[model samples]
Target chain A: MRIFDPHIHMTSRTTDDYEAMHAAGVRAVVEPAFWLGQPRTSPETFYDYFDSLLGWEPYRAAQFGIQHFCTIALNPKEANDPRCLPVLDELPRYLAKDRVVAVGEIGYDSMTKEEDEVLARQLQLAVEHGLPALVHTPHRDKAAGTRRTLDVVRESGIAPELVVLDHLNELTVGMVLDSGCWAGFSVYPKTKMSEDRMVRILREHGLDRVMVNSAADWGSSDPLKTRKTGLAMLADGFTADDVDRVLWRNPVAFYDQSGRLDLDDTDGEPKPDDTSSFEGNSIRRGGE
Target chain B: MPNSGTAPHPSLPLTPEARAWLDTALTEIATAPTTIRTLFPAVRRHCGRAPLPDGRTVDEAVRALLLAALPLRDQALTDEVGALHRYGDPAEQRAVLRALPRLDPEGTGRFLDLVRQTLRGNDNTLIEAALGPYAAAHLPADEYRQAVLKCVFCEIPLARVAGLDDRADAELARMLGDFASERTAAGRPVPEDIAPFLHPFTTSGTTTSGTTIHGTE
Candidate 1:
């Protein structure tokens, strides 16, 4: 099945993972700005990371024939740290970059008052920037957190359809779906939701506006979960068309709202130019 | 010849012939925007690949093209360096660190941040660059000493540090001596690189230049 993983941290992944992803029919992916495994002490570090996401990552993705996009945001957990708050000022410039399809991975981590304030502002930025929201719901007390996330998104007046509430499960999926936003499930080897459990959710939810992703990162995540979920769904009698709708079409429909989402294979024409460079430098080395 | 152990690449200007070639090449790269991976080999084809004594490898010369862009004092040139660093691979990053000499071929300031960045990373190539001559002469004494300790911590051979001879001081000797005692106290043998730092008076090089470790243990 052709797939668009709406939320996967490809920067944390390896080049080998990219090759394997292309092989597994992952034609495109959206890498969101989130907390690295370690805390950053300075806002300059965040900008440097944002620059890489905007500049380096896209170049890396293209080598493997996969289209890479990113959501720029001050992740929920980092919003709590005062040191990182200056990044909010740096957002607008990055949001203007060509491949930045969405302002995302923004939402409540602990539902702190600080997180609430940041969320409200970023949602407004999403509306201002004309980008979709990739909202990350907290792992702890997820049901209440998802509800709180929905309430805040509603408060911003950005429209529910423009927001994607990720890391949803049985208890919280219905509430997010009820709000008319895209419901994103992060299928994992464990924790979030397994492929079998995801198949069950697709069966219950009917795949109308639901999307699945690996949400893969430096943590205990799986990059191939979308491919795995498709196979699992096939085993459970879900047709290829159904897999296409959930993994490919839904994410495309949601993110394409930004109008910046472009896949190389969308036109079925492969980009053969290796000499192409981003900014001023190319990946070209001295010898063949 | 200026000893690299004394004069870092940043202090050394690219030869006039090299400067002209790099100027045209960088204009093509900066204006056209090519990948370092593609530009790296392509530039070498245009400019013959002769390794420098400081051992400027093919990748080093390609990275130097970006550094060359920085000293031109043009906004477009600065952006090119930023793009190259942003998009360049780790080998390219080490080249940036190697290019950190602040000799001001075009009056741009030193690349202390780049040196600090390389020192912060655990990558040996980066560490080697961070501890090279530019870092030796310009890096603050405390940070310089810390970088040496970091080398010991990361198991990088201290011999690779460029200015070990001219910069090695009594303080560094005490630190290495203390480190040796601690190792002896724990029944662990002191690392071989510690010998020169412990006895800098008799050692081959100072923190400034011309240091080489003949034998270790």
Candidate 2:
């Protein structure tokens, strides 16, 4: 079955991950610009990162037959820093880039006033650009963050359907779903929801606008977390159709809203003699 | 010592100042040998090869190399200093500082200064650089073996070399062959983790059944 991981950090993953995901039938991925594990010090760094997302990463993904897409935003954690203003000013240029599916990985981290202001401005930009926003719910004080996120999206006058409240657990899923915005569950290792819990939520929520992602990045997280979640759903007797809708259809529908979800026709069926190396143009020396 | 651009001879006694600088430079070189080695090729590539003034030994060449390489290294280090400050560990910062000579002071001090400033305020990048050696030094034998195995399977660059022992590669090949045989017998989707490493001979075509045949020896 074809699958689409709505959230993943292909930059932090190895080429082996791309091949594995392809082997497991993942046809596409949406990578939202989030803070690298280390804080970035300048707008230049952010611009370079955005360039890689649009340029080099897509080329790398193509080597493994996976379509790569991205979302642009000033992540909440970085918004707290004063030096990040220039980055915020530069967000519009990236928003205009091709294959930017949403303005996101944006939302409250501490529910601070700084976060609120930045989120408000970005939500406005999303409205002006006529694009959807991928909202990242705060890891701490999540209920308050979710509540404030929904409030801002409504106050900003963007359609609720245009927002995706990501990383929802049982505690906050109800408010997100009840408010009519899409709920995203990040099936991660240790910190986020596990596969079993994700399936439980899927069973209860019935997979309307719900989606699952690995949200893997430069940390102790698994890139294959979404596949494990899919396997869990299958083990629980969720039909292939139910699995396909959540893992594939919902993400495609969300990203396609920006009008850039076309996969190369060569990708639909496997091509013979596609023996390309996974390292596409990087000069990193192989280890001894 | 008047007009000699050559480094002090290893056999000849060094002045106290030169001795102190050499000691400090050697310490830094020992800790990050690979980084030093990697830089040597770049420096030589850029600076061109020339024999040292008469009577300089290999040890002196190393010291001279560090002196000549310091400027370029310093520039690269400065560019990454902010990233290091944001992400590096404290011990790594201290080690880097210790390795550099004081470039402002005469002799050893000048070299130390250059090294210090090059690495100064860049602890996070240093820590990441130091991790390979640190992991190689600290990881238990079995864990290191497993990490190397995973790195080989995933194509990640690791400190330890794989395929060093002919027997080891052969044993791994046999185990992989057996696993492929089992998958063929059972008709299961090949595990995603191992699928990348399976050569075309083991898994030839796009068809599900075809994957098993390519992995088989």
Best by TM-score: 1
- Which lDDT tens digits does candidate 1 get at residues A1-288? 798989999889987787788888888889999999899878989887986776567666765667888999999899999999999986876676556789988999999999999999999999998899999999999999999889988889998889889999999999988898988999998798999999998888888889899999998987899999999999999999998998899999998988767554443532421223222122222111
Question: What are the per-residue Cα lDDT tens digits for candidate 2 across B1-217?
Answer: 1112344335434455654555554444444433443232222222222334442233324434353334334445443322322222222232233223322222212222223232222222222222233333233333434444444333434322322221123334445556667767989443444443344334323232211111222
Scanning candidate 2 chain A in windows of ten residues, the lowest lDDT window is A272-281
Candidate 1's residue-wise lDDT over B1-217, tens digit each?
1122222234334555655655565555444553333454234334444556656664376556545433244455445454545444444555666665632333243455667866765444556766776776667666777788777655567778877666677677877888889879989767787787787554534444533222121
- Give all candidate RMSDs, comma-separated: 12.2, 19.4
- Lowest summed lDDT across 10 adjacent residues in model 2 chain B is found at B208-217
User: Candidate 2: which stretches are off by over 4 Å?
Assistant: A266-288, B1-217
For model 1 chain A, the run of ten residues with the poorest summed lDDT: A279-288
Query: Candidates' DockQ values?
Result: 0.02, 0.01
